[model samples]
Target: MREDAESLDIRDVTANWVNAAVLDAQIKERIKSLADLAHTPLFFGRLDYLHDVGAEQAEGAEGESFYIGRRHVHDAQGDPMVIDWRAPVSQPFYQASRKNPLDVRLRRRFGYTSGELTAYEDERLSDPAEAADGEHTSRLLQAEIERPRVGPMRDIVATIQPEQDEIVRSELGGTVCVQGGPGTGKTAVGLHRVAYLLYAHRERLARTGTLVIGPNASFLHYIEQVLPALGELEVKQATVESLVTSDAVPVRGTDPAPTAVVKGDARMAEVLRRALRSHVSPPAEPLMVVRGSRRWRVPAYELEEMVRELLDRDIRYGAARDALPQRIAHAVLVRMEQAGEAPDDRVQDAVARNPAVKAAVKAVWPPVDPAKLVLRLLSDARFLAEHAEGLLTADEQQAVLWAKPPRSVKSAAWSAADAVLIDEANDLVSRTHSLGHVVLDEAQDLSPMQYRAVGRRCSTGSATVLGDLAQGTTPWATTSWEQALLHLGKPEALVEELTAGFRVPREVIAYASRLLPSIAPGLAEVRSVRESPGSLSVREVTTDTGTLAGPVGAADGGTGAHGGTTADAAAAAAGDAAVLDACRQALKHEGSTGLIAADARVPALAAALGAAGMPYLSPGEETTAESRLTLVPASLAKGLEYDYVVLDEPSAIVAGEPDERTGLRRLYVALTRAVSGLAVLHTTPLPAALAGAPTA
Candidate 1:
């Protein structure tokens, strides 16, 4: 197959392209695509049919045998050696079963280790004797599920279940929102859907482009390799922050929860519109055009009429401003024509650029920079009141106003919330570019304004919204997927719920689901198929002193010191030691490990890990071959998974959140991140909800 692919002449395809530069780019792209499949398995499954399904077979053809893989592979004669997983013929490989085997008589799955096929398992659908071997199927599935995850996320193309295949193969023209519990493969399904969409609609998607938006840089890094492994690398990936704030200005910090909630509210859209339109005042003077010293004046009434018409048309601010000068010039030309003077196109062009006309146009419809306008509205109380009078309450308006606002827009220290606002203002001034499709992972955590920012980019396209409502940790998180879909501009999109767990063990998932009632009362309990008895462990920090555990350290290399009694300090110290012990135990496992803690405890825990010579990656850094452990803050641990996870103080994680429900939701996310096992160590007593669960 490799020799056949290499022998194909690319020059023959683009024979007319004599330009070396253009040819080089095209050849480079093709080489990259072909080379990507080298590191991945060529094929993982095989399907044998009783008849040649749809193929125009040769005279001597007996039956159709297809090897399913990530991409297509051809022999020297262009005969198929492997079929792309997204191909129509490959559908039965995943959807086929004993009861409804379609045309497949026998199914074979290959076990791969380091891209080498090591073993193969078979399921004979037609033979009753072989069909009774359920143990064989379970063993293969379990081995694949328990495979050590040491680096970035791998594509699960070889093991996609029937349910997952349905969502992945959904049509590309409409949005599909998936409410999946932890370890349910929702994120993987969303990614594979993107790959499938690209394969199914290559030309259309290539013209507008597709995107995958994850929760953070770390989460993005974790799942970044899946699409490329599936032979789809052209998909763009980014966090909401990176996508929305592409302006030159740098974001400085985050807004307070209350302020952010207000800014993120949908009401801010109307307020911004009013504030921007308020810049257009009544035209007090007429626009005069002097074309070659013959002054042709547009009366004040006509200028006001033009402004009113433009405003009423609901066009963009910048668009209206640009058209104002041309409208006035056309009016002046009309007056000249009524006077029996035939003025050509050149006269109107000259009048439009005339200094007098430009000044009058500026006075009536002055150009407004989105950033400058937002800054002015935030800094000036009277202006904010005029625009936000009916939209926001007096106290809410006060909360939204910046205290000691920046002297100018350039010097302003913009927060993440402010960046969304600026994005909204920019779109109001000018249209935002649309894409073909977008996959929004962990969509439940995005604020309304952030959703708006994401929505505009895909306004003309569609989206795959993947998230768990129970995992929402943000202050402005939507209470339901319906509300989230509405904010995403896909209110009518189909909402699919996936509650079966395929990654985390059943014990670990059941332990984590204890928090569901407290955090998300309406959500149905999640169920996992794999039952690993000792997957969950919760140890109380025992200390001789009042402090719960040893000398604690912050994630940033600081002591976990608090002004208290000597006994209290000792217990705190003891609790720190317990956390390290938990980490040490988890490290003994066969796969990647994560030490997750609250934002406040992260610095202390990081210091402890560093002092203990346990090198760990930060939130945005990927785990490397040399290091199998990472220090993750609870806030950024939403979409990340590890083989074994050591959860720090649960009380502290809860305390770090804005409210009790949100805190529990955050804790729920941290708990379900482990793929193999989980050890939750805490000094303080467990949250009331989890107290009834059996301890390790």
Candidate 2:
């Protein structure tokens, strides 16, 4: 190829790319395409098949070898050097097992350091003696999983487990919901599935596009690189907040928990529907279209009949409104024909746009802006009562109504809950464009209304829903996967569980599992494949030195004002300093360290860390090369991990939550984020769920 390019005439297009000559747009595009192949691995692994099953397949022959990688590559002669992992014949690399080898005899995995292959491992799958365990947990796989911390998340194409591969390669037609424990690779599987779908149906997907929705901006930023690394740079990624209101308007305030819960219910969908349709009023007199010197009139009864027909068809508000004018004009045409006049389609169109006809259409079928409609619903008591009479109780309705309504939708302070409501109203007014596929991560934390908003984007498509039931830590968190699936408009989706964790050690997972029965009783206990015996530790902090005594809480667990108990309250009142020491100690050993505490304790911990000359990053920001310590709020720590985690005051973390169950779930998430070890420093007694367990 180099020789050919060198020998080409200076006027040739190939020479243009090399000489930076002006050329057609197609020539420029080819130049850009060639330039994209400079970096990244060309191939990562190879598969040797037993028979000629893929002989007729493109770039495949009898007993031939295939190199698998993120994307396809070939020589100048068109002979393939690396096959895209999404190709049909590359299935055995991920799905092959002892029970079903898929005619694959040997598999080789290559280790790359800075784009150069440093080592390789070979597994002989055809030999029954060597494949009995059916375990793909090779040393290289472990090394990839435990690779040192770097930047944003990367693709796990080389070490996908058989079970994860099944989910990743599931057919693109149906929805798949995965219940994965911490370190179960659910997020990676979800991203890879999107890449697979785009490859299998590129033309169809390119037309509609795909989306990946995470819980927060930080979580999205952490995974923003996965799809692009897989050669899918066009895939869209956003959080629910950014996808809904940030794209439409700004959200600047917050609502109370009870009000948010009410607004996020699926029942709000019905109320919004009634409120929007209520704007359509009956025509006052009639529709009259004056053309040239003649005038045509359609009676009030006929206009009413036309409106009724459009409304009953269940069409979108804008579509029905636009069609009303044409219907009226069509009626005028019918009258003209009966009166012995010849009128054409152009004549009807002119009549439809007439001033009288447009005024009548405006009166009978008015247009609505979703933001203004939502503001009106929340501000006007009478209007809200009339529309929400049957759907919401009086108390619930009063709770959602704004105390001092803003004068305009633009000036109004919209909360996240209000943003979701606006999205619902927008969908009712006009149809939201559907996508080809959507991957929703940490889905258990979303409200039903949020799910509905996501559902509308993929109504005609499918989804890969991923979350851990026990990690749900919200006031309106879903109680079951079935309920979540139903709300996402994919109730028939297949539900799969992944319990074998590879990141969190066995001791750490078992220590965290004690809270499962109290929080999510229906979920099975998770088991970890990495068994580090001394991974878990608990230290009791004392306040005698007037130092590190964490926050105390009520013993009876009552959280609404009166408090639970005297000692517990006293313990919570006195803040702890031991948490800072633990953070300092954990930073001495390894990769990345997180100082996790309750949302309220964040200020104190940050001050302490800063005073001690430790620079820390929030969970929302990416970890840079200079910083090794991060101060993570419990709320933002759901989908993050670190090498060593320093947890401060379990009781205070629990007290900050609205309820005990949600608090326990948050604690569970915090406890399992460590890849190496965890330290629990508490001034007060541990929660009942973890009180009886061994300390270290």
Candidate 3:
């Protein structure tokens, strides 16, 4: 054959990609053998699947569904939402956001308020979950989307905050802090404030000099589009970890291979780098990891020895340590001893006052050195105080390593930007504070110890805080944000209680508000603002027997057994059957279901479902709802929720301090992810406190 076959068609020898020979033979066969083919279409129908929850087979009866093989599909022609951005009320908003970019009012109003809703960044808050009809906030979001992103900053102006917040926004201080609660729009206002800072101080500080500390990667994904919606680029965004570490990982353990995940890693890294440059570094700090990093490792020790160190050791800390209040100085010593915690010398110098530390030290040490305790910083080894407070995660409080930061962590910390906003400030360790400007989110969720951590990060600048004091949950819930507020140097200056509700429907918000304890009535604003279409429903099923343990009688229960009695294998089988049945029902919902087992060994139960031929999305897999069962270990479920939640625990044991401090919150977050439904199948009856919790 010639090098090029110009005259000859390449069908006969080529692959079966439908050549003339195949087509002709097929058509001939169809014409000769087929009868009454005119009614049939030319091609077979095809289906597109998106979620992990498998479809129910039609074998089941009405009102009762079976996941035999049938599928569910989204309505292709669902109503397209419209918001009037051209309206005059929305014009100023469009102008100001484009001018100032992410003007505070617009960011909070993005979901809760609508005025000619347009794109502020790259996302649409349009959702059926929100109230029907055009809300002023939603419309504003629309206007941001619809308006041209170019032009001077005078275009959209929306003042969603009260005069006081606007005033707070206007203030350009050496250091500033913002605090409050969830749905109070702290994160929204803070993000918008960054745009405002860039607009106001761009000439002085330069856009490159601004840094915005943000939450984790999932949260970054959660809010990634907010900036671009206003026709502005995402300013420097960094997680608190990235802000702290010279070389931080983006959502640890993700692959570095090329693709969307890689791009996200780069974005996370770049934003963090930019934030560091803007706040900590005069120039971009070397994007390389520093060696021989020292960290403080704290563990549980007898309170007696902690006091000796406070009086004797590095109490001669960075200049400010000289001003340490006796109470805090003492408490730090005690926590170091009894709690096996270490003094964050760096953090010690950062706060204006650390009363919690003072109080804790006083409680622990009381200026007495008892022969009963041995506390020379507990110098064995397994525990690394890497920086400071992360040392608490240890179960057995093993040996201690003296991790001294070489060249000072602050040298690099302060090497970047002058002002710092620590996202999730409450989670910050006892150490790691030092900033000209500081802001925090979810302040309501912080406990007294965490509050002290917040205090340590504040400086002389305006300390603006955000988070709903009413949104507090967990044992660490700030019993008194106000009393906690009094611990601040400027309590009165700290009184910016945001009254707007942006995330939940008034109903859902109201429903959640019921969970708030009466102690923090301050969150009544969110409850009052919540619009509801929610109702609580309950279902009961007998426990499964066999392969199951009995209901442990609660200490309060009348039974002599502090735990509930075991009913035997039938109870276990019944409860397992109940969960299986729930999973079947969960797969039918509009959203996905999450099955939280006590540990990773959920196969005995999960394998049953798989043996039933149900599809499943493995935990930590790129989860889509179409699969049958998605198993998630309770630990990995922190900060994430599912559409449907099923919690399975063979034995519900409330164990240890560390789990209570952090693990329970993870359990709570996972339990809250169900948007539509929740089913708890337990060998134990489950805690009464969680019985009627919100289904995500």
Candidate 4:
């Protein structure tokens, strides 16, 4: 496949330089897509149909047999050697069952070790004997699901479950919201859906574009390579903040939880709309345009009527402003025609550019700078009060108001919420560019305004919203997927919940689900398929060691303070030691190990790890064999998984949040990150909800 793509001679195929350049780029992309990756098999599964399936069949074949892979591969004679997973014929590979064979006689799953096929399992879907017995579980599928995760996230095309394949293959015209719990492959499903959509509608999506929105830079970095690995390189990825941030309003500061919540409320959208419309004023003077040896006059009342008509139309702010000049020019043209003079569109356009007409348009409809408008709305109390009179209460208005407004937009300390506000105002002035499709991951953490910002990007297209409601840790976390979809402009979107676990072991997920009743009462608990005993361990440190002999403050560039009592210092040292021991034990395993701790406890843990001669990487850093340990802060642990995890002080993780429920959600996220095993160490008592959970 690679040789065929590379051998294509496009140098003399085009007649012009532009065509040649475009062809060259396309050829290069095709060559890249065909490049063979080391250890990644060309195909992972095969399907044997009951009879000859299609018009194009293998030479001398009785029943059609097709190999399923990530990308399509063909021989020199244009005969398919491997079929793309997104192909319609390959649907039965994932969805075929004993009860419903779908004409698939045999479904074979391949297991690979270091990219070489080591084992294969077959299920006779069409066999009546097997159908009468019961369902058949493939050992290869379970092994693939329980495989130790090492570095960044990988594509799940080969391991996609029937439920996940349905979501991935959904039509591109409608939006989908997946309320999947931890380890349900929601992230992978969202990504594979993009690959599938691009396959089914390549030319359309290529022209319209696609994007994947993650929660933060770390999560985006972790999953950055999944698409490329699946032969998709055109899709873009970004965070909500990055999508909204512009040069005029870069996020340089943060808002208090209360303030950010108010700024991110859905009401802020209406407030921004009202504030922006306030810039338009009724024209009090008449407009006079002097043409060649002729004077065209428009009455003030007539001009007022034009402005009123434009406002009533409720088009985009900039669109209406652009049309206002033409309206005035048309009025002048009417007078010209009434005077027995002939006029054309060119003449009307020329008149619209007239200084008198331009000045009149400016007076009635001035240009609005989105950033400056937002600045004024946040800075000027009277202006904000006028726009937010009924939308925001006085207390809510004060909460969002800047204590010290900067003199200029560039100089202002814009928060993330403020950037979203500017984005809204920008859309009010002009329409945001729409993409063909968008995948929003970790969506529960997004604010309403943030959802609006994302929805604007795909207002004319569609979206795949993926998140776990139980993992919402933000103060403005979405209360329901229904409300979230409404904010996203996709109120009619289909919502699906996935409760089956595939990554975290059964014991670990069961332990983590203890907090579900406290954090998300209405959500169902995840039913893990893999039952691995001794996968979850909770250790409470009771023994105290002496204080650290070295200065612990050096870890965070703080002065060493040894002012605590002997017992306090000893207990702190002992807790640190226990966490270190847990990490060491986790590192003894074969895959990546993560030491997750609360934001407040990171410095001390870092000092402990350094003193113990343990080298570790921060979140988002690529994990290597020699350095497979990553010290993840509780806040950044979402959307990240490890083979083994050593979680420190669940109580501290809970306390890091603004409220108890959100805190418990954060703790739930931290607890569920383990793929192979989990060892939780805590010196303090567990939360009431987790107190009754099984411990080691």
TM-score for candidate 4: 0.96
Sorted on TM-score, highest at the top, how do the candidates line up?
4, 1, 2, 3
Provide the TM-score for each candidate, comma-separated: 0.92, 0.90, 0.43, 0.96
Q: What is the C-alpha local distance difference test score of candidate 2?
A: 0.82
Better of 2 and 4 by TM-score: 4
* Top candidate, metric lDDT: 4
Runs in model 1 with CA error above 4 Å? 1-19, 36-39, 55-63, 126-138, 292-297, 332-351, 544-558, 562-566
Judged by lDDT relative to the true structure, which candidate is superior, 1 or 2?
Answer: 1
lDDT of 1 by residue, 309-338 (tens): 999999999999889878888898899999
Best model per TM-score: 4
User: Could you report the Cα RMSD, in angstroms, for every candidate shown?
Assistant: 3.3, 4.8, 22.8, 2.7
Error of 2 at 395 (Å): 0.4
> Model 2: which ten-residue window has the lowest total lDDT?
553-562
List candidate 2 segments past 4 Å from native.
Answer: 1-41, 53-63, 113-116, 131-136, 246-248, 543-577
Worst-scoring 10-residue span by lDDT in model 1: 54-63
lDDT of 3 by residue, 1-696 (tens): 111223345475557676767665544543333222221111111111122212221111222111111011112343212111222122223333222322112223332112322332321123333324333334444333223211111112233344324633455563334444333445666655554554445454342244444334554444444444332353555544455333321222221112111111112222222222121111111111111243222333422233344435533222222333443344444444564555565544432144444443333323311100111112323212222233233431231222332242223222111112122211121234444344554455444433443445453334455554444433444555465564434465545555555332344334334434432543444422333344222234453333344432222321223233345445544655666777787777544566766443354556656666767765534224456457765544433335556665522322211333233433333444343445555554444434564442
Poorly placed runs, candidate 4 (over 4 Å): 55-63, 544-563, 623-625
lDDT of 4 by residue, 132-223 (tens): 98896689998888777777888898899999999999999999999999999999999999999998999999999999999999999999
